[model samples]
Target: MSNIIGFNNAIFWTDDTEILYCEFSNTDPNAKLESTKAKLYIKAITTLCKGKAMPFVIDLTETCGTFTTSVAKFIVRNSELKKLRISESFIIGTTGVKLLITLYKKFYDPATPFRIFADQNLAQAYSLETKQKYHNSIKKVVEDYK
Candidate 1:
């Protein structure tokens, strides 16, 4: 697990899935969310996968942070983002939250697949399916080489 920039949260990584789990609690209302850690985590996955599929499953079940313009752009530019499974636990119909959701939906292309899950278990199951596909591809490549 990698700590957030401000040590407010910790990102948990797993070889079973590309999901980044951040467990946060009682964060400041107006505090700025540092995404550098998230960026670094994504970079790590990209490096490990080496251009292969790296779908993201963000279990944001306990944190609240406005997705700034820079983060939005980052999400758009990450080509390996096959799926984004976000947990909609704290986010309600607030103005800022709505705006962020609208921006993501507007900017994200239809070809890019994404979904919001209510719990981590469902998200993990979906991630497993994606991992299986990736594993199959690797197996095929190895067999071809043989």
Candidate 2:
């Protein structure tokens, strides 16, 4: 079984494998990432994580555009989110995104552990292994996009 939640531009879900998954699309390449949108997305993810430590896999292969430094900082420094997330995060993306993540890692200290991958299957496998190691099985509350 699986649970899905999303907006028009992104989606968050989980399958029986017990990994939290996120995918992005329909993003404006020219637009800066809005803080409100970022917060909303985090709220959705927080709900899915159910305050339990779990592995996360984010598919950024189709995501376009850039977010503000403040948004990135919030994601990396937020104490509440840090507490909710456990295990390593796997990000699936292009070389550019991987470089961005590398730069972010170089400049700022993140609260959660993460790695970037070009292959989704590899990311999934990594997350699955993490989930198994953590023995996490948090149930997600899925909602339809309005």
Candidate 3:
């Protein structure tokens, strides 16, 4: 079982050793993400990571509900998340305008890798597999790619 760490009315946020996992809250599928609540969610992530770079596995199911501009900014552009050190991110259930809107909100930070997936399990597995690929390789390349 996952350790219960924080609260969300319509989103499920779980903490693990390798990544931050988020999905729609089964308890409140109809819940909407208010702009006011975005801060709480963003802060929770930075607090949990505590400066360690980690991958994010996000399920955007509930996000299809009424997500506002402020909420999008909070999720994708908050300067506070710099401390969270997001190594990479994996998203599920986003397409069309929603995906484009989200893509627009995220400012390109070349260091951060972003990917989309259809399956949470695949995203999770890849997140773990690619953990070291982003967080560990700091030294300059002494050799060309094989």
- Give per-residue CA lDDT, model 3, range 57-81, as digits (tens): 7666445544555665566666767
Descending-lDDT candidate ranking: 2, 3, 1
Give the best candidate by TM-score: 2
lDDT of 1 at 75: 57
Q: Write the per-residue lDDT of candidate 2 for residues 26-141, one digit (tens) a residue.
A: 55667667889888888888887777766778777787677789987887787767775654554645676677667776666554567778778888787777666555333232
Q: What lDDT would candidate 2 get against the real structure?
A: 0.72
48: Cα error in model 2, Å: 1.0
lDDT of each: 0.51, 0.72, 0.59
Candidate 2, residue 59: Cα displacement in angstroms equals: 0.4
Q: What's the distance in Å from true for residue 56, model 1?
A: 2.4
Q: Worst 10-residue stretch by lDDT in candidate 2?
A: 137-146
Q: Which one wins on lDDT?
A: 2
C-alpha lDDT of candidate 3 relative to the true structure? 0.59
Show model 3 residue runs off by greater than 4 Å. 8-16, 26-32, 85-88, 94-102, 105-111, 139-146
Give the root-mean-square deviation of each candidate in angstroms: 5.7, 8.3, 5.0
Off by over 4 Å in 2: 88-93, 109-111, 134-146
